[model samples]
Target: MVSLGYPEERFEDVLEERRCNSDLLFSARRFAPPTYKHRCPRSPAALRRAVLDSPRLQQAIREMAGEDGDTEALRQEAQSILREMGHNQGMTVVRTFAFMLSRIFKALFRHVRVNEEGVQRVQKVVQECPIVLLPSHRSYIDFLLMSFLCYSYDLPLPVIAAGMDFQGMRLVGEMLQASGAFYMRRSFSNNPFYWAVFSEYVQAIVRNGDAPLEFFLEGTRSRSNKSLSPKLGLLSIVMEPLLRAQVFDALLVPVSISYERILEENLYARELVGVPKPKESTSGLLKAHRILQNDYGSVFVYFHPPMSLKSFISGRLDITPFSMTPRHMALRLSDTLRVLVHHLAHSVVLRQQHGMVVTPWSLLTTLLLQAPSDHLFPTSCNSEGGVHLPDLLHDVRCLRTVITKIGAMQDWPDAQSHEAVVLSTLAMNSSLVTLTKEGRVLLNVDKVDRPKCRDDILNRACTVLTCAAYRNHILHLFVRPAFVAMAQRHAGSVEDGPTFSHFCFLVQLFSEEFIFEPGSERKDYEEGLSLLQRCSSLLYPLDSQHHPSTITTNFSVFLGQIFQPFCCSYQMVCNYLLTLEHGSMQKESQLLASLQEFALQQLLEGRSTELEILAINVYKNAVASLSRLGALRRERRKDGVWFLTTSQLHHVADAVASLKPPSQLPAKL
Candidate 1:
């Protein structure tokens, strides 16, 4: 049930990969019956029309129209909006495109491997009840891939909740519509008419159970490639059916799509660093056709076990959307739904439930990004010219052991041996890894082109960003170890590991760069401390005190490299935060705006390209962390001012100085 690799032509390579990694493949057990083709009982167009004609929707339209004092006019307006927002379920077209797009994807990627077992679980859920497939949004291609994956598995194609961006592309829009993609604007909080029409359309689809539903919980692709705070807008609208009892039960399946390389990594990096995003258009898509010619390595689709709404709210509390007489009432109960939406989105980020695929490329990229650019070869391989394969192998084993101990790899039972996993990953990513004439290994990220123009400069920038994006896939897993390493360096003695209070203080400092699991601060602190203890024990077994001297210097160096970029990013942000006028409240957006400018200025001043120091996502995270620590406080939700505490500023400055490696930053703090 491991990913069945892409492209029939490369089927042989898939077979060879399986043969080598057979020890780690998912069981080939068919837990369910072979799935037959499923067709929607009602077309999305028909559902929209029914909702438009529903008495409840008509009443809501009339109520809104009365504000302008024109009920009939508003009714007509509502119908027009419904027509614009509706999705067309062209069954024949969907089937045709499914066949064609499969070929297209196979052509685009070196391999496309679907977790057979995960897909089967989803298929079973499809038969039992309605499903809302909430996958992480990493690329525009996610929308198509979700539907395509369902279609390939003989399950009914999902009605994808896509953004209005795609709706503007004529042929592309029409094709997407024909294949069951419904478009919604990024915002409609002011447009009551559009909101009613859109809400009804989603509810009708869910109620009818004609097709499984799909949407990105994040609302848009994350430029940083990490999970963003979830946007509750669409998820709140879609869950109205369950709230109103129109559907007895709906399963929320959080999907994790891991790519060896992102298709839009360079463009995303550009946007992250303050380049205005180019709007999605037919011409833009056509211009991007060059992507198909390039190899994008492999894509993995892992479906986490689904969550039931009834179970999610069990024994906690209840806002009975049940008491509401109609589906429209559920939409009006925004606060209740928002709480539920947050839980659903947060669950998607929780590692225990999220089905993340850890590939060799991710592992290797982590090592490469962590290692100093100048120190590309292992210390033992100083006379050699390539990568130190043995060191990498050991690190891979260590990472696998760490993740396995924490139960992150439980879903993929076949990924048994860490060595096999690393070997298989290297074999699959043959293009990225190579041995030099001196028999040393090196990642080929240094193929710099002399930029004669802005386009060339941007292109090289994108290349590095794409590589960083891959490394980021495993970045979260390294957070605690990195913190331990950095904190130890600051302690200035290996024998004296930071006190629990000091370690927790360090966690607070790096909060912007890593997301710890949600719990009481004490629980998070304990978990971090425990992980450090485990890692220290594994490396320095003879001495359990986590003494720096007892730990192998090689292991210590590896941990330092892992911790460096985050520290660099933190130092840059803290420097900016310290400059803010004490007691002067700053709006979140305004604070981030200033920080973004500072990041760009530093980039121009020659910052390391090894990490995304200017990343807006990390900047926002730092602000959130500061707020949690009482260094900043929100004055009001919309007041747009975060009160900065001068007293807490000193602590932040101190933490930043301690974590900053002397080699990277000046000694003066």
Candidate 2:
């Protein structure tokens, strides 16, 4: 049925979103109905304890059918109705039949994108039986995205297992049932009785192949663009029944999604770091709504080929708690889903899935960061292989180039269009101010229909310099000396963890998609000062001597810095300034002073070279920031030779003074 309400642009989007949900039902796997339709939300155990919880609901169901039958009569009458509609599981009450109605209603309020990949592949696997589409969780909106995307792609409408914390939420409750959704207690795993019922019901669906049951494999959204480790609790439902029935032919489809920028990154990061994130206050929520209304983020998704559960079982894949472990399953599934998530994240970054229209902000951001740092300073190049700033037009040149390289991808419009799109996007929303040779062309305005000129070159060069200034700061303080030294220690063990998982989480955090929340971090650290110190030592290189400057070292530094604000006791923050040594000026005197403070009241003996690395990296970070306008790219000569412009070496007393922490470097890394 068409929507029967007033429709406007805002509602148009909302309605489209709803329709997207409806579309899923058309194509989703239909699991078999439970043998008995309880007609109530209460558990059988609970019902065994109570009077008829279903009486009222059953009455409502019968009333909907134009009759007032006794409970037994009702059961028998339900049988007739079931017999009438051969597909009916039980007397499907419109009230209990809410799942059907909701699907139709959803047709009015959703939007989706199921590229050709989603359509063809999903249709084949989902048409005859129930299948789980395990996708990465990165947004609260992920569930909505999955439902809508499936619908748009003409895939089956899945009955999603949603958390029950907000049960009785009139709007939410109605919405869930309407979309063929049911509740699973957020805390029910601990409540064995409820767990059994939920599990059994899910099994019935999968076993009967009435409706496909879907669960997010990760259990939670990933803070970075990477896929998270799967929480196997929910998947246990599908497996338990399969194990019991000795039936395991179902396919597990991995669906992946990526957003231009996750609106919840800051929110989720704070929580992960143990900071509280109460729902925004009403006023704050309203303000956020206004901001969201104006955001122009591109969204992307991919539907991967299905992995058959039966294949695993037949292959002797263990599913028992003892024999088959969640960690083991997670490791394997994570490996499978990680590839899909990477592709999705990459696709969004590159705008390959959806045709990309370069805005002034993106164009300018690319120019600023992608400018060769050497050109900005003119004297910093290494004799070995030099750093290469991606060509401004390379992506525009290669159709197959992935999107995750967006920080440097150049998909400029042809000379003519590039100039126009850049100018237009700038005027619309681009905002970068640079001091340059040809005076200042407002980045947004300069991007206009004007022909590309020497001005583009001048402005980019200067903009590059400014960004470099900040990147250099990051290197000097957190990266260059500190993490680089720490990486040296662990260089041998680096290959132990899954390389892909590391890339997904640690490496991705430094990308533009996330930023550290500079909120009340000091308070947290003060409580766990020792933890920070221990972590600093643990995170730094394995040993003192042989650290090399590699991307991995740079990556470690970035990770340390990202965790710094919340690291509490760690003084490797941008807030601190350098200071005079406690007593003398000998070899590593300043470094020693910093370490002494970090180890203050906690350590029993003298500091080691490892601790010194920690202190020096912080000092270098401050120095780098002080010099490079606050960026973290290390400064090198235009000759491709690297240089150590550490703050300790620089004689800028005033600038060094700015980096001293308000408090001492809490004897931590």
RMSD of each candidate? 7.5, 19.0
* Per-prediction tally of clashes: 10, 90
Candidate with top lDDT is 1
Candidate 2 global CA lDDT score: 0.37
Give the per-residue lDDT digits (tens) of candidate 1, residues 1-669.
232222111111222233343221212212223322332555555686688787668778667766568777777887777666677877566656755665567667766666666677787777776778888888888878877666546666677888888888978888888888888888888777677777777777777776778888777787776666676777777666666666777788888877777888767878865678998789988888787776676776767678887677666546474546654443464565566567666666653224556666666676555544434422332444344555566556565565555444322326467556656666555445555556345544444322233354344445445556777776666566555555566676544335445556766665545555444346655565566666555542222332111113334445566556666676777788778778776777787888866765665445544335656667777777777776666575555456565678767667666665534321100
405-429, model 2: which lDDT tens digit per residue? 2222222334555445544443433
Give TM per candidate: 0.77, 0.43
Segments in model 1 whose C-alpha atoms lie over 4 Å from true places: 1-40, 319-340, 351-353, 374-435, 439-463, 480-517, 520-530, 540-560, 580-597, 600-611, 624-658, 661-669
